[model samples]
Target chain A: MPGDVNLWPKLTGGEVIDLLASLHGRLDRARKAELLERFDLDPTKRTRTCSKGNRHKVALVAALAGDVELLVLDEPTSGLDPLMELTFQQCITEAASGIANLVVTPPTLEELFVHHYDGAPARAGAASTSGGAR
Target chain B: MTTLTRSRESGPHAAPSSSTALTGTRRLLRFGLRRDRVRIPAWALSIGGLIAYFGAAIPAVYPDAAAMQTRAEIVRDPSGAFMTGPGYGLDDYTPGVMIANEVLGMIAVAVALMSILLVVRHTRAEEEAGRVDLVRAGAVGRRAPLTAALVLLLVANLAIAAVLLAAVLLAALLVNDLALPDSAAIAAGAAVVGLVLGSLAAVTAQLSEHARTASGTAGGLLGLAYVLRGVGDAAQPGGSTLSWMSPIGWAQQTRAFVDLRWWPLLVGVGVAALLLTASFGLVGHRDVGAGLLPARRGRPAASRDCSAPRV
Candidate 1:
C-alpha cells in the first residue's frame, strides 16, 4: 500500500475491502469487522462519496485484515486523522507480533517510534526494532 | 512466542512456482462480471431492442413486393449507401434483407461502441486509477487482470449475440417471417464485430497511458472504419476494395440476408486474434501503470513560483 491509493469507486467500502482481501488469498473477516469499527468507516458507503480519511481506512483495512506473508506500507496513513492514525498504529503493532513481516516507510516510522519504542530508538533505528523484516 | 511457533510450524514458504501466470483469471473474471452485471445487461438489451424494434417496424413500412422495391430503390441511392451496408440484397429486398442492410450498420456501430467502452473500462481504467496495483500486489497473477477483462468481454459479446438472435427470431415469428439461418447470421455478424472492435480496444489500452486516450483511439479507429466502408460502399454499390480495408466492412460483407457469406467473418476472427495476441504481448513487456507510448516528460527544474520562499 502507498500514500495515495484507489479502489473501485462504484463499490461500497465493504465490497472493496472484501475483494482486495480475498485477492490476497484469504480474508480475515473478524479482523476486517474489528478494523472497520475501529476506523469508524461506514462499510455500506460507496468509496466515491467517502472522505480521503475514510478511503484511506478502506485501503488500510483491506491490507491489514489479510494474513499475508509481507505488508509493505509507504506513507500509509497520510490521509488519516489523529484518531484513525492511532487506530492504524494499534493495528500495525498487533500485526508485528503475527507471522507476517512488516515494512513501513517514514513518517509512519517516526510516529510509531514516538508511540511504540518509549522514544528510545532514533528515527533511523526504529523500524528494525518494531518487528519482523527481511 | 506463540506467533513465532506458529510460523515455524508452517515452515518455509516456497517460491510461487506452483501457481501459473494465469492463476487468478477465473476469479478476476467472476468478479469483473459481477461488477458489470447491471451494465452488461443494459448494453445487451438496448442494442438488441433496436434490432427488435426495427425488425417489427420494417415490415409495416414496406408491406408488399412493390413497396419493398420502392424502399430498395431509395436504399440504393448514394446517401442511403453511405449510411447503411454495401446495398446488399436490395433488389430482392425482404424485411429480413432490410434489417440486414439498413439496421446492421446501426447495430454494428452500437455494438462496437459498447465493446470498446466495456473493455477500456475494465482494463486500462482500472490500471490508470491504481486499483490494479492493489489487486496485483495480492495473490493475483501478472496476466490475470488483462485475461479476465478480455474473457469478460467475450462473455458479454456472446450474451449480446444471444439476445440479438432471440430478438430477431422473435420478430420473425411474429411479423417479418424471415428465415432462421439468415437471422442467426445477423446476430453472429454483430457479435463478430463486437469481438473485433473489443479486441482492438484491448490493443489500444496497451498503447495509451490514459483510459480516455485508449478509448478515444479505439473509437477513432471505429469511425475511420465506418467512413471507409461507407465511402467504399457508396462508390461501388456491391462494395469496392476500400470497403474490405475496414473491419466493419468485413462484417458487412458477410451479406447476411442476401448471399450470407461466412468467409468475411473468418477474416474478422483472424484480425481479432492478431489484436489479442498483440495486447498480451504488450502486457508482458510494459510496466504496470505505464503504456507502450512514452508519457510526456516533466521539466527538470521547478517553476519560479515553486522556488520562491513563503513568508
Candidate 2:
C-alpha cells in the first residue's frame, strides 16, 4: 500500500513499491525519510487519515517521482511552513524545466509579482475637476 | 536532500509502467468504498425495509382469496392498471403478488438513484475536486477509475438484491398464510428490476459531465421505463410481449405468487449486462474527468446579466 493504508486490499504491496520506484527521480526520498524520522512515524504505519500538510507532502512526493508534463497545481503551497514553501517553489521550478507547470494561486504570496490596472478615466476626471474648481 | 537537488538530478524522467494504472484503480475504489460505506448501506437497508413492510402489510389488508380478488379487480381497471400494472386475474391472488404490483417500481427507482449517486460521486466529483489530475499523473489509465466505480455499483446492487430476497422471505414466514415461493418470486422480480435500473444509471453517469446532469439523465430514463411498463401492462392484461420493452414491465411480468414465471428474470439480467458493457465502452473512449459530450464552456469573464445593478 505504499504507506497509504487506505488503498484497496486488491492492490498488493509490490504494485505500490513499483509505482514509488518509478516516481523516485522527481522526489527527494531522503527528505521524505527525514520528515518521517523527525515526526517519529513508524515506517510500517500506513497513512490512514493525514493532515492537509501531510497530504500535500504525499502528493508532492508522488508528483515529483513521475514524468508529470503539466503540473496544474492550485494553491499548492498554501498550508506549508516557510521552509517547506521555499522547498515547494524550488521543486516546482525544477519540475517546470522540461514541462509546462501551471500554478494558480490567490494574490497573497509576496514572491509573486502583481500587476494592478489604474483607472485612466477616474484619474483624468479628478484632475480636470480639481483644476476647474481652483 | 532538498527538492531542488532532486529535480536537478532527475530531469525528464520516463512515464511509469502500465501496471500502475490498475493499482491506482484498486486504490481509488477502496477510498470510494470507505467514503460511501454509511451511505450505500443505508440506501440498501431502506429499500429492503420498504419491500418487507409492503409484503407483510398486503396479506393483512386482504386476508382471504375472495378479498384478494376484489383488490385485483380494482387494480385491473383501466385507470388503476394504467397507474399501477395489468391486474393479473389469478384466482388465488396472493398478498406476495399484490405487494409486487404495488412497490416494485418504487424500489427500482431507489436502486437507480443510488447507482447514479455512486457513479457520479466517484467519477465527475473526483474530477471536479482535481483529484483525478493527481491520480491520472500516476500509473492510472483514463478508464480504470470508471471501471472500478461500475464494479462497485454492481456489488452494491447485488447486495441490495440479496437483502431484498431475505426480507421478502421473512415477511412471508411472518404472515403465516402466504406461500413461500410466491414471496420469493415477488422479491426476485423486484430485485431484477432494481438491477436493470442500477445498470442504466451506471451507463448514464459516464455519458454526462457533471453529477447532477448524470442523475437527471438516469432519473428521466427510469421514469420513462416505469410509465412505459405501466401503459403496456394496462393495455394488454395477460400478454407479456409488450412488457418486455420496459425493465419495470419485465419485473412485473414475473407474476410472482400468481403464475410465477421465473424465466423473465433472465431478461432483466441480459439488459443489465448490455447496459454495463455500454458503460464500459463509453469509459474507454472518454478522457478522465470528461464525458462523451464535453461540458460547454461559458464566457471567460462575468456577464452583465450576472453582475447587473439593482433597479
For each candidate, the DockQ is 0.23, 0.05
lDDT value for candidate 2?
Answer: 0.62
Error of 2 at A124 (Å): 37
Please write out the lDDT profile of model 2 over residues B1-311, one tens digit for every residue. Answer: 00111112343545445454355667657656766788888988898898778766766787777888887787777667777765664455666666667666677667767776777777766665555665665556557777778778777777777787787777666666456676666666665666677667667777767778877887788788877877777776753456668877877777765677778789888998998888778776665656677678789887787789668
What's the interface RMS deviation of candidate 2?
A: 17.8
Clash pairs, candidate 2, are A23-A65, A26-A64, B21-B139, B21-B140
Model 2 Cα lDDT, one tens digit per residue, A4-82: 2123223332233224435333444575564444333333423344455555555555555454554434456655677
- Choose the strongest candidate by TM-score: 1
When summed lDDT is taken over every stretch of 10 residues in candidate 1 chain B, the lowest stretch is: B1-10
Reference-based lDDT, residue B136, model 2: 61
lDDT of all predictions, in order shown?
Answer: 0.82, 0.62
Please give the range of 10 consecutive residues that has the lowest summed lDDT in model 2 chain A: A115-124
- Best by DockQ, which number? 1
